[model samples]
Target: MLMFATNDQLLKNAIDDLGKYVDLKDLGEPRYILGIQVNHDKKEQKIKREQKITLNQRKQIDDILKTFHMEDCKAVKTPMDVSQWKQSLARATESKQATNCPDVPYQSLMGHLMYLVQGTRPDIAFATNYRLWW
Candidate 1:
């Protein structure tokens, strides 16, 4: 369990209180949490109002792509219009067409991608949602 408090004394007190009931080992500041890289600047963090912390999941995204065998895929720089997506989905899921993937774990792939979308990649949320629904 990770807990933070503005006051150092209060946080130490809480930790001490919890330690009595549970075996607690302070891991000291976290470097990463849940595959997201935690970037902290102590100098910059001095000012509470202007302080900023960044969380990155590039490693997780790359691992996801490699796991799904999409490492060498080309990047789509152009922004696709919503209409184009609807048209694409319509053709892909036509009533007469029989689409089946017996070998590929498509649902599993979609589920993994969905996690990425929820974490830090909202850009692919629509695509993941469509795959999950359709």
Candidate 2:
């Protein structure tokens, strides 16, 4: 679960204090947890990096869905046109402008799609990353 604390000291103290109630001995300090990574660098302030997904990460998917905005979009068994979709770096490059062709909502949808790819949807990684190229 994502957690937010008022300050660094509070977070540190919490982690230290958690040792008393939760045994984290079985888990390693996560290098990458969920779509975010926890890193420590004395030289830099803490930053949350999105390990997967990129800008315009799923424009095609969202653009298509948006066209059906008023229509019902039930969760489907698949995320894309599985039978016809093919991964092509060249195609993605050529289609970059088209993918980035929309506005704020499309952009937001792209971000959400990227988060989805980072979370539990590994199957969409290729397509999502492909979208990133665009």
Candidate 3:
């Protein structure tokens, strides 16, 4: 965590007291980090961050699976595909029709998946990234 104070004495004291043990790196005025946009409002002394994701991000993921008629997909204990995704690119590239994956929608889903992976769904990180890049 970082702390700032209007008083230089306070800032110095705080840093001197705590700086010995903490590893601090200053990346000034963050505009983007981890696919999220951060805006600092100088007048209001406030920070605002927003990341774009489909309003129905989770629903999209579920709907895609359901549309593929995977509602009855075996309820696997784990979220990631441990075995097959490594070679998914080859299959994806060779497919003649844009049936299972299309460019525009796939990109949108990839964006949503990326945001989800960064936030609440860490377990799906590898699987989603693999699926997207492939």
lDDT winner: 1
Clashing pairs in 3: none
Error of 1 at 22 (Å): 2.6
Ranked by TM-score, top first: 1, 3, 2
Q: How many residue pairs clash in each candidate at the backbone level?
A: 0, 0, 0
lDDT of 3: 0.58
Top TM-score prediction, candidate number = 1
lDDT of each: 0.75, 0.55, 0.58
Per-residue CA lDDT of model 1 for 1-134, tens digit only, reads 88878677889999999999999988877878987787777777776644456777899889978988899998763244678788877877775232565667777788777777777777877666766665
Candidates 2 and 3 compared by lDDT, better number: 3
TM-scores across all candidates?
0.74, 0.34, 0.37
How close is each model in CA RMSD to the real structure?
A: 3.3, 14.4, 12.0
Candidate that beats the other on TM-score, 1 or 3, i.e. the better one: 1
Candidate with more favorable, higher TM-score: 2 or 3: 3
Full ranking by lDDT: 1, 3, 2
- Compose the digit string of candidate 3's lDDT tens values, residues 1-134: 54656665887788777868886665555554454444455645333333232222455557656655567777544465546554555566777334654544666566766776775567777777666554
Which segments of model 1 are wrong by more than 4 Å?
46-51, 76-80, 94-100
